[model samples]
Target: MRAERRSGSLMAAPYAAFLLIFAAYPILFALVLVFLKWDLVTTPVFAGADNMRMLATDTRFWRAVANTFVFLSIHLPLQVASALMLALALNRPLAFRSFWRAAFFLPVVISGAVVAILWSNLYATDVGLINGVLVRIGLRPVPWLTDPSTAMPAIAAMVTWKNVGFYVIIYLAGLQYIPRSCKEAIEIEGASTWQRFRFLTLPLLLPQTILVVTLSTINGFQLFIEPYVMTGGGPLRRTYSIVLYLYTNAFAYQKMGYAATIGVALALIIGSVVFIQRRVIGNAEAL
Candidate 1:
C-alpha cells in the first residue's frame, strides 16, 4: 500500500508543479500587485488602495466595460440562436453531413488573429465582398468597420459565426442523450411538430443552454483579438475591450500595477457575471 501511494504521488508531481508555476503563482502575484505602483523601472511602491480608487472613477475604463456589455448584448443571443438552429438542422439526416459538420467547425480551430484579419477585409468600406454584393444589387454600401454604429455589431457577428460550431457540437451531444422514448411519446400525443419541439426538445436542452450562456459571457469579457486586429478598437472606441485596455496599461504605458488591477477587476467581473447567469438560468431550469 505504501509503495502504491508513492507511485501515485510520483505520477501527480508534474501536474502539481504545473499548477504551482502557471496558475497559483500568477494569481498570487497578481493579487499582490493590485496594491502597489510599479512601472517596471523604479522600485515598487505600496500605494495601499490608490489603484482601486483610481479604477473606480476611470471614465475610459468604464467605457470599455460598457463596450464589452454592448458586444455581449449583440453576441449572446446571436450565438445561441444560430448555434441552436444549426444544431437542430444538422441533427437531421442530410447528404454529406459529416463534411458539413467539419466545415462548420473549421473556423473554431483557426487562429483568432487570422480569423479577425479575414473578417476585416470582408468588412472593408469599399472593395469588399459584402459591399460588392450590395452594389451589385444597386443598394447603398454600409460601412461595417468604419462606422461607430456598425463596427461592434460587425465584430459580434463575426465572433458568432466563428464560434457557433463549437456550441453546435455541445447541443448535438445534449440532443443524443435525450431519451428516444420521450420523443416518440410526444409524437404519439397528437402533438404537432412545433408543439413537440417547443414542449419537449427546447425544455430538454436547458442544461446545454445554460452552459452556452456561461461560456459565451466569459468569452465576451475577454474579447481582444477581434477588436485589436479588425478595428484596433476604433470608430470612436466603440469596440474597445477590457483586455485591450489592460494590455495598453501594461505594455504601452508601462503601468504594471494598474494593469494588474485591471486584470483582477476583469476576473472579478467575469466571475460575477457568470455566477449571475448560472443562477438565473438554473432557476429557470428549475421552473
Candidate 2:
C-alpha cells in the first residue's frame, strides 16, 4: 500500500510542481504586492493598507462595479433565453443544421479584439447596418455606443449574441440527458407544451442554467477588451468594468498595490455573488 501511494505521488509530481509555479506563486505574490507600491521599474516601497483603503473609497471602482451589474442584468437573461430557445429550435431536424450552428458559434472562436473592432463599425450611429435598417423603416437613428444609457446595454446585447452559441451547445447537451420517458409521460398526462417545459425540461436543466449564470457573471466582471476597444470605457464611463479599472491602476497609474487590492476585491465580490446566486437558485428549485 505504501509503495502504491508513492507511485501515485510520483505520477502527480509534475502537475503539483506546475501548480506551485504558475498558480500558488502568483497568488501569494499578488497578496504581497497588495501591501507594496511598485511600478515594475523602481524599487518597491511599503504602502501598508493604503491600497485597501483607496479601493474601498474609490468612486471609479464603485462606478465600474455598478456598470458591471448593469451589463450582467441585461446580458444574463438575454443569453440564457436566447441560447435555450435556439437549442430547442435546433433540437428538431432541419436543413443546413450544421451551417446554422457554425454560423452562430463563429463569433465565439474569433479574437475579442477583432470582435470589438467589427462591432465598432457595426454600431456607428450614422452608417451602421443596424441604424441603416432603422432609417429605411422610417425610424430615427439611435445612438448605440454614444449615449451612456444605451452603451452598456448595446455591449451586453453584442456579448449575448457572441456567446449565445456556446451556451446553446451547453443547453443542447443538457437537453439530451432528460429522459424521453419523462417527457412522454408528461405529455400523456394532458400537460400542455409550456407545462411540460416548466415542469420537466426546466427543472432538469437547472445545472446548466447555474453554469451559464456563473460563467456569464465572471465574464461580465472581467469585461475590458470590448469596452476598451469600442468605447474606451467612456461616454460617462458607463461601460467601465472592474478589470479595466485594475489595468488602469497598474499600467497607467503605476499603482501596483492598489491594482492588487482591486484584484482581491474583485475575487471576493465574484465569490459572494456566485454563492448567493447558487443559494437562491437552489431554493427556487426546492420550491
Candidate 3:
C-alpha cells in the first residue's frame, strides 16, 4: 500500500508542479503585488492600502464596471432567447441539420479578435453593410461603434451573434436529456405547445440556463478584445471594460500594484454577481 501510494504521488508530481509554477505562483504574487508598488523596472516598495484606496475612488474604474453592466443588459436576454430558439429549431428533424449547426458554431471556433475586426467594418457608418442596407431603405446611416449611445449595444449584439451558437449546442445537449416518454405523456394529456413548453421543457432545461447565464456574465465582465479592437473603449468610454482598464494600468501606466488590485476586485465582483444569480435562479426553480 505504501509503494502504491508513492507511485501515485510520483504520477501526480508533474501536474502539481505545473500548478505551483504557473497558477498558484501567479495568484499568490498578484495578491502580494496589491500591497506594493512596482513598475516592472524598479524595486518593489510597500504601499500599504494605497492601491485599494485609489481603486475605491477611481471613477474610471467604476465607469468600466458600469459599461460592463450596459453590455450585459443587452447581451444576456439576447443570448438566451436566440440560443434557445436555434436549439429548438435544430432539435427538430430537418434537412442539413449538421450544416446549420456547423455554420452557427463556426464563429465560436473563430478568433474573437478576427470577429471584432470583421464587425468593425460591418459597423462602419457610411459604407458598412448594415448602414448600406439602411440607406437603401431610405433611412440614415447609424454610427454603431463611433456613437456613445450605440457603441456598447453594438458590441453586445456582435458578441451575442458570435457566441449564440455555443449556447445553442449547450441547450441542444440539455434537450437530448429530456426523456421522450415524458414528452409523449404530455402530448397524450392534450396540452398545447406553449403549455407543454412552459410546464415541461423549460423547467427541465434550468441547469443549462443557469450555466449559460453564469458563463455569459463572466465573459461580459472580462470583455477586452472586442472593445479594444473595435472602439478602443471610445465614444466617451461607453465600451470601456474592467479587464481593459486593468490592462491599461499594467502596461500603459506601469502600475503593477494597482493593476493587481483591479484584478482582485474584478474577481470579487464576478464571484459575487454569479453567486447572487445562482441563488436567485435556484430559489426560482424551487418555487
Candidate 4:
C-alpha cells in the first residue's frame, strides 16, 4: 500500500507542478504586483495603496463596469431564451436531429477572435450582409458596431449567437432528466402546454437555469474579445470591457500595478455577483 501510494504521488507530481507553475505562481504574483509599480523596463517599486486608490477613482474603469452591466442586460435574456427555445425544439422527435445539433454547436467550437472578426464584416454599415438584407427588406441600414447606441447591443446579439448552442446542449441534458411520467400525468389532468412547462418542466430545470445564469454572468464579466475585435471599445466607449481595460493598463499604459489591481477587483466582482446569483437562485429553487 505504501508503494502504491508512492507511485500515485509520482504520477500526480507533474500535474501538481504544472498547476503550481502556471496557475498558482501567476495568481500569487498578481496579488503581490497589485502593491508594486513595474513598467517592465524598470525595476519594481513599492506603490503601496496607490494602485488601489487609483482603481477606485478611475472613471474609465467604472464606465467599463457599467458597460458590462449593459451587456449582461441584453446577453443573459437572449442567451437563456434562444437556448431554451432551441433545446425545446431539439428535444422533440425530428429528422436529422444530430445534424441539427452539430450545426448549432459549430459556432461554439470556433475561436472567439474569428467569430468577432467575421461578425465585424457582417455588421459593417455600408456593405454588410445584415444591412444588405435590411435594405432589401425596405429597412434603413443600422450602424451595428460603430454607433454608441447600437454597438453593445450588436455585440450582445453576436455573443448570443455564438454561445446559444452550448447552452442549448445544457438545457437538452437537463430536459432528459425530467421524467416522462410527470409529463404524461400532467397532460392527463388536462394541463395545457404552458401550465405543464411552468409547474413541472421549469421547476425541474431550475438547476440548469441557475448554471446558465452563473456561467453567463461570468462570461459577461470576462467579455474582452468581442468588444476588442469588433468594436475596440468603440464609438463613445459604449462597448468597453473590464478585461480590455486591464489589458490596456498592462500593455498600452504599462501600469502593471494598476492592471493587477484591476485584475483583483474584477475577480472580487465576479465572485460577488456569482455568489449573489447562486444565493438568489438556490433560495428560489428551495421555495
Quantify all predictions' global Cα lDDT against the true fold: 0.93, 0.91, 0.96, 0.94
lDDT of 2 by residue, 1-287 (tens): 99999999999999999999999998899999999999889999999888888887889999999999999999999998999999988887989999988888898898889998898888999989899999999999999999999999999999998888899999989999999999999999999989999889999999999999999888877888999899989889999988898999989988888898899899899999999999999898888
TM-scores for every predicted model: 0.98, 0.95, 0.96, 0.98
Locate the minimum summed-lDDT window of 10 residues in model 3. 190-199
> For model 4, what is the C-alpha lDDT against the true structure?
0.94
lDDT (Cα, 0-100) at 150 in candidate 2: 97
Per model, state how many residue pairs clash: 0, 0, 0, 0
Prediction RMSDs, each to the true structure: 1.0, 1.6, 1.2, 1.0
**Model 4 alpha-carbon miss at residue 275, Å:** 0.7
Q: Between which residue pairs do clashes occur in model 3?
A: none
Candidate achieving higher lDDT, 2 or 4: 4
Query: Candidate 3: RMSD over Cα atoms?
Result: 1.2
Per-residue alpha-carbon lDDT of candidate 4 for residues 15-92, written as tens digits (9 for 90 to 100): 999999999999999999999999999999999999999988899999999999999999998999899889999999
lDDT of 3 at 99: 99
Best-fitting candidate, measured by lDDT? 3
Q: For candidate 3, lDDT tens digit of each residue in 187-215?
A: 89998999889989999999999999999
lDDT of 1: 0.93
